[model samples]
Target chain A: QQQVRQSSQSLTVWEGETAILNCSYENSAFDYFPWYQQFPGEGPALLIAIRSVSDKKEDGRFTIFFNKREKNLSLHIKDSQPGDSATYFCAASGNNAGAKLTFGGGTRLTVRP
Target chain B: NSKVIQTPRYLVKGQGQKAKMRCIPEKGHPVVFWYQQNKNNEFKFLINFQNQEVLQQIDMTEKRFSAECPSNSPCSLEIQSSEAGDSALYLCASSPSGYEQYFGPGTRLTVL
Candidate 1:
């Protein structure tokens, strides 16, 4: 069973538009959520992260809206640019799980200029 | 621009051959993690260590795979015998506080 899930396999959006990627998880023990961006032939880079105590986190044009009660979250990329095209992964971890992360399948995003 | 460094961007090994990869964590980071990413982009955690002590590892790692993080040398992961199923990208990450991790470019291993 996949502990973490992303709603879309791929998503496309125009430049200047907002692209939202959704994610959900099964294990309630997960308390820390992080989003990673990966380019071709490169490892994933941490984009943004949120603790279960908060409902939202924003960094530059990227924002994460989290609903702890629902076990779901969304990443919103505002003013999407072609340079932002990449694969995004949602990962979760908890104190019980140590520092190991459980990652979702990932969502490939494309921004058309 | 990750400080973590992984050697041999790509490797090709015949079946049953030993495959080894190395990772150097970021400066001052004590926690290190290894993960395997397949062609399908599925990530499987292999093992993790804090300083020179191992914290956790999967069953596959406990068997065919061996990893060690020495006090001053770069961390290494070695497969006892390579298999077709072992083909994947190996990623190494380091964490300052164990909550957030930064990843390296990764080493792609192809087994025939």
Candidate 2:
């Protein structure tokens, strides 16, 4: 079974708009959630992360709103830029899950100028 | 730039041939993980290790898929007998505590 899931297959937004990507997970044990960004021909890079203890985190234009009760999370990129176009993957892990990660099917984000 | 490094960005092999890939984790990290990503963007967890000890792995043909992480040497994943189903991108990542892993550019494998 797919433990982690991404609700959107693709999302499009214009520059300067807020782009939101939603993700949900089935394993309740999941405590550590991370968002990775991948540009074509490159490996995925850590864009943002959130622990279960916190409900929200922000780094400049990027923010992660986490809902532990709902087992869902959302990544919000404010002031989106054309350069920000890439595929985003949501991943989950926990103490019981070990070092291995369960990843969600990625969301391809496109930003129009 | 990613601190992790993977060798041979692409590999093409005939069915039943041998295929190998290497990864060098970031300095000071003690944990490494391997994942297989198919064309449809599905990620399959392959194996993971802490230092020289393996922590977890999936059930595959033992004689076909083998992986190891040795001290002072780069980690390696080898397929003794390749199959068309093995055609995918292999990604390597490393972390200090396994909470967050840094990924390297994947090695695309094609089995004909």
Interface Cα RMSD per model, in Å? 1.8, 1.9
Candidate 2, number of clashes: 0
> Candidate 2: where is the Cα deviation over 4 Å?
A96-98, B61-63
Report the lDDT tens digits of candidate 1 across residue range B1-112: 6799998889999999999999999999999999999999999999999999999999999889999999999999999899999999999999988889899999999999
Listed per prediction, chain B TM-scores read 0.98, 0.96
- Taken over the whole model, the C-alpha lDDT of each candidate is 0.95, 0.92
lDDT of 1 by residue, A14-109 (tens): 999999999999999899999999999999999999999999999999999999989999999999999999999999999643479999999999
The local lDDT score (0 to 100) that residue A99 gets in candidate 1 is: 73
Query: What is the alpha-carbon lDDT for the whole of candidate 1?
Result: 0.95
Segments of candidate 1 deviating more than 4 angstroms: A96-98
In candidate 1, which residue pairs clash?
A: none
- With candidate 2 superimposed using the best TM-score fit, by how many Å does residue B92's alpha carbon deviate from the native? 0.3
Tens-digit lDDT track for model 2 on B23-51? 99999988899999999999988999889
Q: How much does candidate 1 score in TM-score?
A: 0.98
| DockQ, prediction 2 | 0.68
